[model samples]
Target: MATTNNIDNKRYQGLIISIALFLSLIGALLAFTFYTSSLLERNTALIDQTNQVANSAQAVIKDLFDLESSYGEDISSPHIQRVLTRLEENTALITNSLSAIEQGGVITDNLGNRYQLPNISNDARLDVAEAKEQWNVLEPKIQTYLKDANNIMVSSADELAQAVDQAKTSSLFINESLDKLTRDVFSNAERQATTIRLIQVLGVAAIFAYFLIFVFFFVRRLRETDAEALAARRETQEIMQTVNTGLFLLDKDLKIGQQHSRALNKIVGEENLAGENFTNVLRGRISDKDLNTTKQFIEQLYNPRVKEKLVDSLNPLTKVLLHNTSGTGSDSRFLDFKFSRVYEDKDIARILVNVNDVSDAVYLEQRLEKERSQNDMQIEMLTTILNVKPKVIHEFISNTKAHIEKMNNILKNPGSSQYELEAKLKAIYRDMHSLKGDASALKLHSFTKIASDAEDKLSALQNQGALSGNDFLQLAVHLDDLLSLSNTIEMLGERINQTSAASTKAAHTTPTATAAGVRAAGAIDSTPQANSQVIGSLDFDEGEDIDLDDESDSHLLAYYQDFAQDIASRQGKEVQLNSATLEQVQIPERLKKTVKEISIQLVRNAIVHGIEPPTDRRSAGKPSTGNISLEMQSVGQDFIVSLQDDGQGIDYDSIRQKLVELGRFSLEEAEQLDRNQLLKQLFSSGFSTKDEADEDGGRGVGLDIIKTQVKESNGKLNVNSELGEMTRFVITLPKAS
Candidate 1:
């Protein structure tokens, strides 16, 4: 692997170097070409200027000849003046041109363009000097003749002849000198042209030679690189075929690279995965939310600033549950996808995805976890059963069985209409909540969790604006699980009971022990009747008949106390259950079960919601232990059951917030509701101020359960509270006839 990586690195470096060198060569060639072209332009411009100067010098000599010829034709002052004027103009033009040529100065052309000329070569300069000296000798004579012509035109004939002779002599020498200078200038320009041609040919030859050399080495290196790459590709293919992991590269666009491991096809359960959008590949296999998150995750991978290991925690693809699209493999699998950034220098290039089919390992882990959970539940159930009285466990088992049956019946009678379906959901929710309360009260966490999970499903169904029979399909599974759990608990309870009974029988098998055993069993049998007489003596309405006042009623009261304490402990609060008044009142037979269920739910509510924690209680200038008073008394033909807690009272503000959160009322509407109006929302189904539901009172169903039972018994329920002070619930049920 290291060797392959090194080779890859070397190839990348080589590619970079080659590109840089090619660009440099192009730049250098462009610069050299521009420089040579500029030099040629300057040379051409100099040659043109030199030709213009030479033409001006020749014009000077022709003007002199014309002056001399003019004197020969006419000795008139006007003709002489015309000749002199022509001669003077030509002379000035030649002097300026020669001076400019010799001394590197500006020379104006016919079109008024001024060009700065450089000094000519030594040979050309010498020729220019000689021409200037010859012109000087003729210049003074011409000036003298022009002055003499202005004074006396006819007497100047002799002087004009002399001037013509002087002009002829000067013109010969000057022309000779001018010819030499022109030749020298032309020669220099020709030499420069030759040098330019030579330089261009040499430069082009050098460039071509360099290009050939560059191509030779470049091709050689390229062939070697191709060979190395081919070897690496074969090695990579071997590894790809042999390795179990699914490997591929994902570009910034989230497209898979063309080269991918053979295992990727099997792991993703697809062929031709290359060049496909990664999101599309995972589209139907995973959830839309995970797919979107995966896109964002890969995007983050492309960002060089985000550290690979740091963002790894946010990877949504880890341990993804993918349903196989192909019909060949298992119906589903668990694939673990790991991503790492592929870097080019300091920049992120692509993401390397490593996929492993972790189905077997995951399935094994899940099986172990399931077994471990079962073992834990068994241990917890045993601990609970051993700690609790046999009668209590029996009562729990019976209640759970009945609740499960009620749920099953509700499912079986899933109504066709939306309202009826919603009603069915509520009914199941109430039963599940009741079951959860019972399980929690008995510390049967496994059953509580099952019940909670069922409630969660029901809650989801309930939240839907529309309902269908298909929505209830999932509920059947929860019901089945609950029923199975109840059976298991019942069997375990029976086994424990048999074991206890056998132990007792064994302990009392001796002859003397036999008589004591008989007496003990009789006392156990008559204990309910004995307690009934004791309850019958309590002050009550005249015709109030107490139910089977088994020690079960006392156990029921004790259960309430213990249940309150357990809930308080779980919520990190201190609570004292005051049921002295409740103990004295004889609950009528018909209302006994209804009253018990209502009391359990209400007690749980008070502990979970109304009651303040120990710290809050102390801060409220109250005792650390919160007070929960339960009282039942006969009033006229009715029995009034009052449960009050000296803790944080019903928070109307919290209720208003919950109302807004649940979308039952807008924020403005919730704020506008009075205390009396808010109280009505408290009894509404699926309404609670709590953010999240737990096994305890957060589901908001507890108060609804209370209201439901009260309505069923044709009882009146009232609630009153002072915020931060106390909250009370009053239930008034007519005495059973």
Candidate 2:
């Protein structure tokens, strides 16, 4: 043991040493990389300095070349020699700086990166040698030549001037040769410097790479350290096995499942959970029926919808399979189960079913349920009695009650299965259908048919049952659509009622005839100009009930003549609201009074809502103030009097939401209704979308008065607003044949 300990300590010591060595190597490489980079930067800066000198040298050469090109040979003449001497001095300074730069390993700027240059040591030496040798050979010869030439030039006068022409050619040739030699020398120096710079760069890159490799290992070490920390979690798992729950594991078939422990003595057979079917162990122990119920429950848990880990509703041991989604037990029973879906190493699902049996608790629950059921029944009976004098919201109340009552039945019938789901859905459809029938019986035609249509749609998918996920989604969407339409219808009715009351007040204030027989002349105009083709049509696959509250057909011309003649004469147009009616449409007293009041009012409204000024009308391609039309027609037992306009149609949704905001209804309620229903509120008393506070559209008694008078005589008011298009209010009254 002592030897082993010694070795282990040595091994750990070695590891620490290795770690230190690794760190040291990294630091050294980093330092080397930095050092090399600094050297290169200094050298590069030196190279740049040398290059600037070279550029200056080239500029001097170019000046010499320019001078040669312009003057035709006489450059060596005393007049030009002074200029040549000045250029040579500048060249000497530039060459010396270049030689110093090529000797460097370090020549850096403030930012330390190596400028690219070659170590031109050997080439620079050769250049210095060549220049020295050339200067030595030429210096004495040039001095001797210059003295002789100067003596001759001074003495010869006109003859010396002639020699100047000859000297220029020789001088230009010499300058050219010198420039070529300088360029060749500089090129060799640049090439040698480039080679040295590249070698240094590669060496630095190798050092940088070594540092990166060391960092990579350091990062890997951190991950290994983190993995070593999970040892405590393994210990916690060990403690969990001793927990005292009557836990047993079940295979797919629930036989002596792969895992069972001493804690499950009562639930299983023998010391070992011998390979036996789970049902056999419970057989004759907790009634075969209950035993089978537990087995079947395991099967269901094995195949769950939306993937689950625990089932709160599990039945007791029984032979007959049972499901307890509605919660089984006598009165107050509590069965909380936690079933973990275990998988083999291959991830196949097995179950560890944990059950907590609390029948006493269940017995208590049943008692409460019975009490609740009794209370609900009592409410239903009272509501039924109240239906005899049903208010306007009778349908609404009944539907809500029906929804609540269906819950108990659904719970009791657990066909906790696909069939039961289909059955429940069928029941729901039937209720909605019955509600529609009831609405129709009450003359709530607007609300009835939409619900019936929705029911029919659901019945088509009943065969698929709740197990069909697609079916459930489809049903939900349909229900949402139906609910939305229902809300619209209800809102429309409330709006009409409000409008009628307001209009009644308006009629009283205006001193309009109260009796049905009052003569209210309507203007009949020329035929409407709109194309008869329908732009958009809503198709339900089954069919849609046509809402016939529109104001188009023959006999519209007469209405225009009745109303517009009074206004057009002022403009000197002599416009006639002409008509061709098959009959002087005699309206019922109930409808007749509403038509008189509204037709007269709308004619005046046209003066405001429809017509532009005479000048404006002329510019707009109209004769004058636009014509207003009132048309009446007969279909079956109803007389339809429609007030039509060629004016800006209202924005019903905005107006509806606004009215709801103003405390008429909530946004949620208003949104459910369609545009037709929203517009119905326009006739409502004291309700208007306008913020301008006008007496016209909002007379504190708009179309609502018209609706009440019609309704008082057993008639109905229908509103149709084709916003920005035109708005027409159709009043229908039963003919007294």
Q: For this target, which candidate reaches the highest TM-score against the unseen true structure? A: 1
What is the C-alpha local distance difference test score of each model?
A: 0.78, 0.49
lDDT of 1: 0.78
lDDT of 2 by residue, 180-213 (tens): 4345445654564576567557656765675576
Q: How many residue pairs collide in each prediction?
A: 0, 66
**Worst window of 10 by summed lDDT in candidate 2:** 527-536
Could you estimate the TM-score for every candidate?
Answer: 0.75, 0.22
Candidate 2 lDDT (Cα, whole model)?
A: 0.49
Q: What is the lDDT of residue 337 in candidate 2?
A: 44
